[model samples]
Target: MPLAQRVHNLPSYLFAGLEAKATELKQRGVDLIDLGIADPDLPPVDIVKQSLIRHLDDPDAHQYPSSVGDLAVRKAVAGWMQARFGVAIDPAMEICITSGSKEGLANLSRAYAEPGTVVAATDPGYPVYANAGAILNGAGFRALPLTPDNQFMPDLTLAEGARLLYLNYPNNPTGAVADESFYREVAAFADAHPETLVIMDAAYCELSFLPPKPPSLLQFSKNVIEFHSLSKMMNVTGYRIGFAAGQPEAIAALVKIKTQLDSGAPVFIQRAMAEALAAYDGVNPPADAQESHNEYGRRKALLEKGLKDVPGVKQVYPSPATFFVWASVDDDVAFVEHAMEKGVILTPGRGFGEAGEGFIRAAVTTSADRIELALQRLRDE
Candidate 1:
C-alpha cells in the first residue's frame, strides 16, 4: 500500500494552494477580488456553442474518438495555422488533438523524457514545464531564469545539454512576448544542437495587443513542436481542446504515447473547436479577442497606474500580450498575505519558480471595477 515515488516527490500543484487560501478567506467572510489564476471570465463564441449543439445529437459523438483526432478537426487546425502564422503543415502527419495543451505537454514528456534527460524551462514559467520532468521519474530539470537583463528570454547557451527545451511566448505570469528575431536565435540554437526538441507553448498567441500578432517558431524552424489552445483565445477553457503540430515523427511518437494514456478529446468538443477554427479569418480579430483586449487594456492601465504609487511595489512589469501583470516586490509571500488580508488575492511569484521570488503575478481576468477595488485594497494595506 505504498504510493509511487513519482507521485510522492512531485511539488504541490501551485494553483491548488491558491484556491485553498481563497476558500479560507471566503469562509472568514472576506469578499475577495481574485487576481490569481488566468481563467477567462468570458464564454465560448456563438459558432462554437452552435456547433456543439448541432453535433451532440450525432450518434458518432458519443463513442470514443481516435487518439489522433477527427479528420475535419485536423484540417481546420491546419487552415487556421496557415491563416494565422503563414505556416503550412500536413494535418495527417503533423497534427494531434489533445485534451488541452497541458495534456499534449505531459504526453510529450512521456514519449521522450527519461531519467537523466535534461529538460530546460524558463524559471517563473508555467509549472507544467517542470512537472513534465517530475512525471518522468526525475528527468534533469534545468531552470533557465528569465531576468530583466536578458529581456525575459532565457539564454539558449544555458540549455546546452537539454534534450527538451520548453518556451512559452506571451509568457504566463511574466507576460513577455517573443519576437521573430528571438525565434531566429532559437532556430539557430536548435540547429546547433540538432538533437534537442523545442516545445513552444503558444497558448497566449492570440492575446497579443499589437498588430501583426505573434509569429510561430515553426516559421523559423521545423525542429520545434508548437501547442495551441482555445482556452485563452476563444474562451473555451471548459472544452479542454487544443492541438500539437510539428515534425511528423514527433507527432507519431505523441500519438503512440497517447494511445496508451486515454482516448482523444470529446467528439462534440472537437467538432465545436473545428467549427470555431474554420471560421477564424486570422485577419480580423474575433469578437471575443477584441472584447478581452479592451477589457484587459483598461484593467492593466488602472493596475499599473495604481501600483506606481503603492508602497513596496518595486516595478510593474510591461505586459503587451497576456492577461497578467508581473510585478517586482520586496517579498512575494509577504505581499500575497498582505493583499489577501485586504480582500485582494494575488499569486506569489515564488509559486511559479524560485527565480520568481521577490515578485508577484496579478491576473487581469477580472472586471475593471473589481481591479479598481483590488488596487484600493492594496493602497489601504
Candidate 2:
C-alpha cells in the first residue's frame, strides 16, 4: 500500500546506510567505537529520578494529563523561567506543557503557517525546522545561511517578513551560540516586524562549559516562543518532558492543535520535571546539570586532541557548548566512511543541510576510555 505523500516528502534519513553497515560490521565480529549521535551518557540527576519515583504511586499521576498540561506543572515551568532568566511568564496564559520541544515544533507551523506562508530558519539547522515547520505544512521555506564568516548565526535581516522564524542556540551540529547583542538585534527585528513570530529552541542552553551560562532570548524580547527541554539538561530524554512559553496567542493556538493529537505528557513525568526544574540555583544550575558538561568536555577534548594532527581534518570547529564536535573535512562522506573502516562511527555533515557539506560531526556521548580508543584507532595506535 502507498503511504501518504507527507511520508515521501520527508528528507532522506541521515543514517540511512550507516545502520546497515554497523550491523554488517558487528556480524563480522568488528567492535565499533561510536561517536555518532549526541545522546547523553549520563543519567537524570537524583532529584529528577527521586521526583519521578515519589510521584509514581499517586493515583492522579496515572490519569489522563491535561492536554495543555496541568496548572501546577505550568506554574513550575513559569517559576523556572523567572528564576533562570528573571522573565515573568503567566503559567495560564503563556506556558503550555509539551511532550517535548519536538511536539511543539511540529505543531507550531500547523497552528500558524497558512499555506504558502514563508518559514525561515538557519541553514545547517535541525531538520525538524525544515520538515515539520515548512514542508509538511506546505509553507515556503527560506534558508538563512550559517557560514563561518557569520559565526553560524543567520542575519536577522535575511529572515524579514517570514511568517515564523526558528532559532536554535548552542546550536545543533555546529554548536555556535548567540550572545545578548545578537538577541537584541533579534528583538529589534521582531519589534519592527510584529507579524513574524520567532521560535527559540533552547535545548542546549544550559550545557555550556564556559563561565556565565547562555542567556535566554526571552530576556530581550517578548516576541519569541522558547522551547525548553529536560532531555539534555536533566538527562531525561526518554521522559519527553518539555514546555513552551511565549505570547498567550501562540500558546493558545498550539494548545488547540495539540487537543487533537496525543493526550498529554504523563502527569508523573510532568511532576518529576517540575521538581527537577526547581532545583536550579537561579541563573546557574547546580551540580546535577554541570556533571554532563564536565564529562562531555573530557570526551570532546580527546577528539579535539586526537583529530588535531589527522591529515584529512582541516579544522575542528570549537564547540563551547553542546556534546558534538564539528570539523571541516576534505570530503565529509569519505571521512565518515574512513572512520567507520577504522571502527569509529561518525555522522556526515551533509546530513544536517547543504551548508554542512564539507564537515563531519563527532559526538562525545561515549565514555572517555572509548573516546580515547576511537582516537587511537583513528591514529593507528
Kindly list the per-residue Cα lDDT of model 2 for residues 1-381, writing each as its tens digit.
998777788887868898889889989999998888777878778788999999999888998888899999999999999999899999999999999889988897799776769999988888898889988887888888887888888988889889999999889988887878888888788778888999999998888888667888888888788999998888778889899998788899899999988788999999999988888888766586677678877777778878776768888878678888888888898889889999999989888788889998888888988988888888773
Residue 44 lDDT in model 2?
79
Residue-level lDDT tens digits of model 1 in 151-186: 789988988888888889989878898878999999
Candidate 2 stretches greater than 4 Å from native: none
Candidates' C-alpha lDDT? 0.85, 0.86
lDDT (Cα, 0-100) at 184 in candidate 2: 88
TM-score (all chains, Cα) for each model: 0.96, 0.97
> In model 1, which runs have C-alpha deviations exceeding 4 angstroms?
13-18
* Alpha-carbon RMSD, candidate 2: 1.4
